[model samples]
Target: MQLVEDDKYGWSAKPSSCEKGHAPKEISVDFDEVYKSIILPAINLINGTNLGIKIDCTRGEDLLDGGNIVSQFLQKICQAEITITDVTGFNSNVIFEYGIRLSVRDSLNILLCHEGVKLPLDFAEQRFKTYHMGLGGGNDAKDYIVETIRHALPLLLAEKSVESVENLFRRTVENATGRTQERRLMEVFEPAPDLLVRLLNALNTICSEANAPGDKKVFRLDPKLRDETWKLLEEIGKTMENSSNLSRAIELYELLTKLEGFREKRRDVFYNLNKLCSANPDFKEKAQFFLERGIELED
Candidate 1:
């Protein structure tokens, strides 16, 4: 929330004019001063790629559409196609938003560390791009961060426009059910990851073993049990994913794909599983196995 004292980055200025019929490449930034310094640098980096991905940037404050400020910030993080977060300071709000972004979309974020700041041990093995805001490297630090991002985000430079993971996830979930059904489906989200996963997989296993071909129209789980299972799966998937346990999240999602009322959510499950395959090679093969099984069930 701490922005650099600059007029150009829109901290104290009004939002910029929108370009007609043009959807410029955009990324949400987490912290301010360091974030502000990188704005121009990121634009130059994208332009230098000759990839036509002009950069537009925003922090939490820029999204004030008269909604609750906290909710707006969470929504922006949830919705950003790509989010660049400066973990350099370990700001609590920044960390919170970063967690939200991870749960919403696994592979669409770039972690940034400051020159001398110590990072959390949990993400020690995680790769973070380093920058030196007002430190020795200064603008050169921004240059390093941008360059590092471009390499990790090679998809951004591809020939065609790339869809955001958030947009794709939303579309998948929406395609699985309508607005009201989606709301009802998302309501069972208790946040205790282990417990939630336990309950979901327990119920999921029962549904799987109990399910039979040409039996009833479907294996009818108790209505309450069905709703609560999906709800728990949703929160568990997010908690595991945010903890960098993509494989575990994959297991939870795979189980969700087997539940009776959740057949329609198979694509949503696949969407998450596919995103995670990049983290572990075996996940792709595992995903293929689930795809084949789920498809056979439909047939």
Candidate 2:
């Protein structure tokens, strides 16, 4: 589509200022590049895991303009029912709206199995109270106002439920304190069997959607969440000896490789290749092949 060319919809009105040597800036319509660079890579990760996302994009010339462009690509071109809304004054910040109902279900299952997960009650309550009071709680809430109690309530529940599970982790880690706070925190609160099952199921769904024919677009996962997921899978494979655990690690590695264009950390892939091959003898040949291939590419 070009500024001068008319689409079936209609040609874009020429800038009136262009008559005075003032031309409207040309916008690149590389929605395909955006999908390949941004959306499709994330979808690849989802393919390796069973996770559903409700991405709410804020409205603005800066955000909605670009968002609409992406949205049109996803909705019209990709033909996926990715919910996009125009909440008043919603800035361009992205929110990872993990389903609270889903979290509550996982929590109930964890309790039923008597499985130990960190689920921190205090942290959950604090998060709940913040949301209940219509205060900002989600990663995106810092920018947007809490409009309705209805919107805030489910968020509070989910935050608290996840926190309750997180608390159990805090107790486990109370003894070990060190420089790798993030890594240490994760090591403390391993996912219960139920949570792992839920995550695996979600990943399966994402992978199916991604590999489905007609359009194989990428679904983006939250960076922190994605890291945590890969960590959880690696831990599970090491400690639990579950087959799905190793499979997920491999799938996530493939997704990360596909995202090479968006990232600068090339060595992480080689590091994971070493760990993955060492951990699973079954994957040794494939891992070795890729490792050699990477060296050749580097050379």
Candidate 3:
């Protein structure tokens, strides 16, 4: 299959002679300027000589047959070899499509977002790659994203088996008895203390490098590592809250609110801080500040 330009849709696949017998490998994407200029170019670079692979993005206008749009979307999500979702701005339709892909497929569902865009609470724990649209004339951002996808694609394709969220829930319900169910749920949310410690160390190292002088300064991290760190921090804050260590939880969340790349739009952090601060008499004013900030970010 080869990528063919269209007058209406931005890109689609045209089957080549070699792909006549076998089904073409497909990568489904949520189309936007970022995907058109950055993501697609990166994929093309890494997809060299792999003409059987096709990139697909469905536009609303493409559903001209009077078929239900939702049905068509669901079919695309289920059929694609991989789905790359752009979750920026927390668009409800995109989030719904992403959820469908996650529930049905265990792996090869990648989320991409703009740097500093706050995701919804339910999806804050999900791993996503972020790209900077304005950093270093955009080339650095594109290069970083390209390298990330290049490294990830091979590993994702090599996986022999994977577990979907639906399957996990089904398994849990099948095997869990009342108390065990609670414990299982807790286990899913809470990472081991050792893992938390390691994540903390990694964050510290990144920060230190970022702060280092001149040529050594690391402005941003690998997108995967950055997502992992954000998730870890959020989890640690929640763990502290569960243990009744509200002060520590507040501290952790506050730290997130001060961290670069996160401080601007981390609504979850501000929301948690607002809740935690409201519980303490001394922080009433701070609580209101956080609440207002969170509302601003939400808007």
Q: Judged by lDDT, which candidate is best?
A: 3
Task: For model 1, state the Cα shift of residue 33 in Å.
Answer: 3.2
Worst 10 residues of 3 by lDDT: 6-15
RMSD list, candidates in order: 18.5, 21.6, 20.8
Kindly provide the TM-score of model 1 when superposed on the true structure, using C-alpha atoms: 0.41
- Candidates, ranked, lDDT: 3, 1, 2
Q: After superposition, how far is residue 172 of candidate 3 from its true place, in Å?
A: 24
TM-score of each: 0.41, 0.30, 0.37
Residue 49's lDDT in candidate 1: 70
lDDT of 1 by residue, 1-299 (tens): 11122111111111122211111223222334454566555645665676434445666556634423443355445544456665654556556656656665554466666555656687656776665534444466566656755674454332222223223223333443464322223333323322332343355455545564555454545566556665665555544433335554555566566666666666655655554563466566765765565565553
Q: Which ten residues in a row have the lowest lDDT in candidate 1?
A: 6-15
What TM-score quantifies how close candidate 2 is to the native fold?
A: 0.30
How does model 3 score by TM-score? 0.37
Which ten-residue region of model 2 has the weakest summed lDDT? 6-15
Task: Report the Cα lDDT for candidate 3.
Answer: 0.51
Please report, in order, the local distance difference test score of every candidate based on alpha carbons. Answer: 0.48, 0.33, 0.51
